[model samples]
Target: FVSEAFRVFDSMPEKNLVSWKAMIMGYARNGFCREALKLMYRMEAEGFEVDDYIFATILSTCGDIQLNEADSSATCYLETS
Candidate 1:
């Protein structure tokens, strides 16, 4: 299922924040925390704006640890949302 999910994700013509969030959240909830977090970093690096859902989902990966470890983009979203 995850493999298929990634297959679709990789084939996306143009991904917005929603698509990124879905894939990341899926991986996170399915015990693929590392992959999820890695994608989150990639998302931020790609200059996508994070929203409340994205921020909360990312933080849920490992409680305050994820937030503490999040880069400036995530913190910016946290402050705003």
Candidate 2:
């Protein structure tokens, strides 16, 4: 489904942040954290701005996994922002 969506979006003459966000969020919600993070990194590398909401959501997902270091880092990021 996500791949199809990405195909459709790519076919569009104009693309925007929201389109990318939708793909990222879909991956996250579907339990594809690695893909989500990869996409985020790619977006950053391409100079696409990531909004705070995206950060918060990704952090929340990391917290849900309860990985010690990841949770701690997420908490730190949340607290500092």
**Could you report the Cα RMSD, in angstroms, for every candidate shown?**
4.1, 4.0
Q: Which lDDT tens digits does candidate 1 get at residues 1-81?
A: 987998999899999878998999988677665567678778878898655676566567645444455445456645654
Number of the top-ranking candidate, with TM-score as the measure: 1
The C-alpha stretches of model 1 lying farther than 4 A from their native spots are 61-81
* Residue-by-residue lDDT tens digits, candidate 2, 27-80: 777666666666776776677887887876766665456335455544564575
Instruction: Please tell me which predicted candidate would have the highest lDDT against the true structure.
Output: 1
Check candidate 1 and list the clashing pairs: none
Estimated TM-score for each candidate: 0.67, 0.64
C-alpha lDDT score of every prediction, in listed order: 0.72, 0.68
Error of 2 at 40 (Å): 0.5
In model 2, residue pairs whose N, Cα or C atoms come closer than 3 Å (at least 3 residues apart or on different chains), thus clashing, are none
